[model samples]
Each structure stands twice: as C-alpha cells, then as structure tokens.
Target: MTRAEGRPLRADAQRNRDKILSAAVRVFAEDGLSAHLERIAKEAGVGSGTLYRNFPTREVLIEAAYRNELAKLCDAAPQLLESMPPKQALRAWMGHFIDYATAKLGMAEALRALVESGVDPYVRSKEMMLDALASLLEAGAQAGTIRADISATDMFAALTGIALASGKPEQREQAERLLDLTLDGLRTSPR
Candidate 1:
C-alpha cells in the first residue's frame, strides 16, 4: 500500500483507522481492557480484520487511543488561550485535566499491565503536559493575570493533586471549588 517509502495512508484506510481509534477510546473508557476487539470493530463499523490490520494487538490499540486522547488535550491549551483570556484558558485546561484524570483512573489497570510489558505509554506524558502548562502560564504571567514566580514543577504538582482529588464522582463539586481556589492562588493580586 506504500506509494513511496513514507507515503500517507490511502483515504479509506485512514478513515477506518480513525474510526477504530475513536471506538477504542469510548469502549475502553466504558469497559476497560476487557472490551473485545470484535465489539470495537462493530462500534467502528469496520471488520475485525481491518481493526487487526490497523492495530495488531489490544495493547497497541489502547496505547494509540490513549496517546490520541492525550494529544487532543495537550493540543487544546494554545487554542483555548488564543480564543480566551489566559486565566480562563488555564482554568478550562484544568477541567480538561480532570477529565483526563478520570479516564486515566478508568484505564489504570490496563495501563499498569502495559507498563509491566516494558512499554511505557506515559514516558512523554509529563513532558508534554509540562510544556502545555508552561505555555499557558507564560502567557498568563506576561498578561499579569497569573504570578510569574510559580515554577512549572510546582504548578504541575498542584494541578495533578487537584485533578486526582476532584476527578471522583462524589467530589466533583469540591473539585471545582478547589480548582477555583488554585487558580486564584496563581493570580497576581493588585499591589
């Protein structure tokens, strides 16, 4: 199928792959690693063979689906900042982070097994998240909306704590208030 050494996917193949990834995310989110390949293919409207062609194993599919979801989250920071104030953008990203955490908790078992298999699906996760946070924090600092003194490491820890704490079902409201408080702490008060 290669028109050249690194040629792009044929249109239909690309479409099928996208469909499979989308279905994999939802199915995994709903049913975790036990979700079957046939069910995923059915949800994607593709054949099991097509799904296997795109992703030969469940681990590969899960890894791809996870990375895709992560890219979507990390990629949103700049777009959100572009369309809104940096402060609002940062807050919105926290919401995204919470969603990510919730999904992560659901996928925890599968991800752990993936780790045991010597494949680190999260190797670049912290770096990517830190980069996104740095970008937003830099913009907010330049705008004098957020404090410039906050370290990226510190911010990441805070966000991670907030995400884990608020990512639970019964504690979602508390998470919102905690997030607001956390954002307030980042704001530079008038001198």
Candidate 2:
C-alpha cells in the first residue's frame, strides 16, 4: 500500500497498483519481459496512464511483480502457523514455496532483464525466505513434530535445489514428491 519511497498510496491507487502487479506477474510469466505495456494495462483493467503512473517502466514492473510474489510467500509463514499445527504449517508453506518457485521460474527471463538493468530484485530475498523458514522450523521443533537439528539455511538450500530441479508445470508431481521427501527428512521421526 506504500510506494518504494515510503509514501502511502491512496486506496484507489493501492488497488490499481495491486491489480497491475498481479496482472504483470501473469502477463510476464505468459508473455515474457518483452510483453507490451498496453497489454499489461488492459489485463489489469487499468488505463495505460494508470499503469505508467504505477510502474514507470518495464523493469520496474518486473521487479515489483517478483518482489510482490516473494512477499506473499514469506508472509504466509506466520499466517500458516496461526491456522495449523506447526508441522502441518510447514508442509503447507512448502506448497506455497512451490507456487512461488513456479512463478519465479516463469518470470526467469524478466528477472534476468531486471538484473541486467542494475537492480538486484533478490537483494532481501534469501534473508526473508530464511526468516520464514526459521520461524516455521522453530515452531515445529518446539512442538516436537520436527527435528531441532535442521538449520533454516540447510532447508532453504534443499528447497532451492528442489525448485531448480522441478519448477516447471509438468514437473509439479516430482516437486511434490521432493517436498514430501524434504519434509520427511525434517521430521523428528519418519512418519
């Protein structure tokens, strides 16, 4: 709801921004970074002017879309914990991770373009993901459902490897199996 410069967006502006980001994610994933700005605007149900006001440029939109997806994935950790048992929450969060990975994979070209443009969209990505994983692991460990020996860093690396290996849509079955395997490894006892 706030701009990168920390200025709060008006409610309508926020809505438009959210729409544009969502649309951009889908559009970029389907059409790549060279996707037309007008197409994105139309997909968002906003005018070109509104989209321009919100994003300013293709790279800016790509970065925002990717960051938005990352935030959603990271923010799901506590919410998942609040709604389910810790181990269950971890499993559910891993599903969310797969979804995030799919989107990231879909936008790979767009992100590469953003990186080439001198903006590191992943600047806080690892830290945020690790924090989320740590919170979930700690909760599960305290609940005695998951091993306390696992480090968030280790889990993250494993998850990243799985994502890299099975991130495509057709590879979802394999990704789920890998996730289950990873979760099994994290369990205090095999279940």
Best by lDDT: 2
- Tens-place lDDT per residue, model 2, 109-181, is 9999889989999998999999999999999999999999999999998988999999888999999999999
- lDDT (Cα, tens digit) per residue for candidate 1, span 41-65: 9999999999998899999988887
RMSD of each: 2.9, 1.5
Top-scoring candidate (TM-score)? 2
Write down the RMSD of candidate 2 (Cα, Å): 1.5
- Listed in order, each prediction's TM-score against the native is 0.87, 0.93
Q: List the residue pairs that clash in candidate 1.
A: none
Candidate 1, lDDT over the whole model: 0.85
Q: lDDT for model 2, on a 0 to 1 scale?
A: 0.92
Per-residue lDDT, model 1, residue 81, is 93
